[model samples]
Target: MDAPGRARREARIATFVGLASLASAMGIGRFAFTPLFPLMQDSAGITLAQASWIASANYLGYLVGAVASYVAAVKAPLAARWGLVVVAASTLLTAFADTVARWVVLRLVAGAASAFVLIGASAWALALLARSQRLRWSGWVFAGVGVGICLAGLTALVVASVGASARWAWVGLGVLAAAVAALGWRAFATMDAAVRPARPRGLGALDAASWTLILCYGIFGFGYILPATFIPAVARAIVADPRVFAWAWPLFGFAAAVSTIAVSHLARHAKPGAAAGCSFIVMALGVFLPAVGTGLGTLCLSAICVGGSFMVATMACLQQAQRVAGDASGGLIAAMTAAFALGQAVGPLTVTAAAPLREAIARPSAVAAALLLVAGIALLWCEGRTARK
Candidate 1:
């Protein structure tokens, strides 16, 4: 092959590595439990409150890992390698966890590992693709998260049909993650040359508008997590059959993947903040659907709306940070990430508190939708602030 052909081939490999890495880390390590939680509840008689604690533990660990990744000088490939290993180990170990305490610890470890894997693998893959001028392939890399989610949800649907225990489902996911890690292990080798980022020009570029965007990003996290964490459970309440309710998550994941591609086109016509604000409005509608409407149709529509819009908000928020903060965007972006993680941690706890209510999902969904609507309006104001300045 010619030199150019060789670079393109290497870039393609990098894309696959990134996709598989994120699938294992995010889809399995971070979100597999969401799909499997109902099974765990059935098998172990775990209460919704206990599940909330477990989910919050994972989110808290993700916050810690995000901060560590930002401050540390670790090499990309090394972070990617060990992160994936830990994610697989933590997931597999959860199979033997007999108590809520062990579940919390294992999930915490898995969450932190997922964060590191995301940062490291994304950095490594994007760098390689940029070098080869195949950066467009990066979209497929991120879509892996949704693909993995769909895959996990489908796997759970299958496992439930076969009457396999939740432990067996965990074992299956752990093995699958390990398999992908091993397959893509060599692709990260070429990324060893990547270096730590340079010192920033400081937070001088951050203005009121930037801070508002950060807050809005956090709100987006809180709004989406309610559905992302418990949509399966909610669907089950309406439809006891796994074959029927299990499809909710797969639809959510599919919409997530499609939205990623859709957002790029959206950017061509509107500012990132404007586009993201519209996403929040759509997500607010999604969040409210299940609250007011009944049956599988409304629940599934909610899943599609919430899942489809969160990534748009995420991508747009970071892009807006870069635009508004210029050379100082790194720290600003990190702040937004931490804020988002904190919001996610708070979400399930809110659910746990509402678990005692006569109508848990509707009340919380109402509150979440209200918050989202307020934030959506705030983002539009922030967008205009930039224009006025």
Candidate 2:
């Protein structure tokens, strides 16, 4: 084979491995909690209050993981591998843990691992792809998150159908993470991050537009998370059949995966902020839809709209950060990550505080939708400002 052909082949492998890494980390490791909520409730008789606390533990761990990755310098490859291992162990361990406290501890570990794998695998694979000039395949790499979520959702559905325990779901996903991590474990053991460390910058140094961008990202997190956690439950409320309600999460994952790939191809023409703006608007609609319609069709559409747009929103926001901040993009992105985590962390807690949400999902979802809409406008306004400059 010619050198060009060989390089392409190698790029393909890197992309596949990268996809596997993210699938294990983000999809299965980080997000398996959402899909498993109902199963746990069924088998464990877990309450909403307890579930909220447990879910928040993972988000808190995510925040800690992000901070740990930055405070300490670790090789990307090794971090990715160990992160995968921890995710598998935590997930596998969750199956046998007797108390909710134990589950929270395991989830916290999984949460931190999710961040490590995300940072490590992304840094390693994207750098390799850039060198190979196959950066377009990055979309396929990220689609792994959606793929992982889809698999978890489907697994839960299968488990529910067979009258199996939630433990089986966790075990299957844990094994899946282990298998994927082992698949592409060796390639990144030597690869460093894309380059030398970025210059240290802080929030105080960011300009007003950049500040606005960060806040918008946080709001995006706050806005979308409520639905991400509850879409299945909402569906369950609408329908008694496990088969019908269970489709919500898988549909969510499918939309995320497909839309991510589609938007990547559209990157040639669309500005990142502009793309992010559109996604937010669509997501806002999805977030608010079920509130008004009260039907399964509306719920399914909500899944597609929110799921389809979230990754696009993430990709666009990061791209916009890079465009606006340049070398300082690292710091800005970190701040954005923190804000996003905080936003998500606060999302579940709102359930605990809001008396209305228990009686009517409409009020809180409406609030979330409004936030998303406002944030979407903010992103567009910032993009327009940047374009004019």
Candidate 3:
């Protein structure tokens, strides 16, 4: 093959590796618990309060990991490898934990590992793609999260049908994560040596555009997480049959994956901020659906809207950050990610504190919708300011 062909091939391989790694890290490590929460409650007698705490613990760890990524000074590939391994181990260990405390600790560890995996893998993959002049592949790379979510949701559904416990479901997801990590291991083997480390930049280095991206990204986190975390539970509450409700999460994942790729293509011609702002508006509508329309159709539509737009919004914001920050995008990315993690950490806790378990669902959904609308307006304002400048 010619040089150009070889580069394209390599870029394709790297994109696939990034996708698999993301699936393992974000899909299985971070979100597998969401689908399994109801199962744990059904089989192990776990309470909503306990589940909310576990989710919060994971989000807290994600925040810590995102913050650490800015100053940790590790090579991206090395960090990714370590992150994948730890995520796999933590996921497997969760299956053996007998207490809620143990589960929380394991989830926290998983959350931290997932953050490292996402940040490291993204850095490594995007750098490689850019070097090969295949930067357009990034949307597909980001879509890996949705693919992973779909896989996990389907796996949980299958396991539940067999009357397996949540522990078995965790084990199954851990095995899948391990397999994906092993497949992507070679892609990162030379990444550290090939690329120089990024220089550290503080928050003070950010310009107006970067700050706007960060704040909006944080709001996106808070807005999408309530539905992302609770969609399965909400569906289950409406439909007693696991068979019927189990489809919600997979549908959510499918919408997420597809929407990201579509938005990615659109982003080539459109301004990233405008694309993101529109996505937020649509996502806000999705979040509001369940509050006003309680039927199964509304629930599924809500899942579609929220899942489809969240990752697209993420892709657009990150791309916008790269455009505005250029070489100093590393610190900006970390800061934005940390802000997002903080928002996620607050979502479930807000619900836990605000209402009784049975009545908690609608309030959080409403809050998420409101936050998303605010984020949309903020993004639009930033875009207008940039245009005027």
Candidate of highest lDDT: 3
Off by over 4 Å in 3: 192-199, 353-358
Q: Compose the digit string of candidate 2's lDDT tens values, residues 242-334.
A: 788889999999998998888888674689899999999999998888668777888889989999998888777876776777644555665
Residues forming the 10-long window of minimal summed lDDT in candidate 1: 193-202
Return the top candidate by TM-score: 3
273 Cα displacement, candidate 3 (Å): 1.3
Better of 1 and 3 by lDDT: 3
Residue 196 in model 3: lDDT:
41
TM-score of each: 0.89, 0.93, 0.95
By lDDT rank, best first, the candidates go 3, 2, 1
Query: Which ten-residue region of model 2 has the weakest summed lDDT?
Result: 191-200
Give lDDT tens digits, candidate 3, residues 156-197.
899888888989999999999888778777778854425344
So what's the TM-score on candidate 3? Answer: 0.95
Instruction: Report the C-alpha displacement of residue 128, candidate 1, in angstroms.
Output: 3.7
Question: All candidates' lDDT scores?
Answer: 0.79, 0.80, 0.84
**After superposition on all CA atoms, what RMSD does each candidate show versus the true structure?**
2.8, 2.2, 1.7
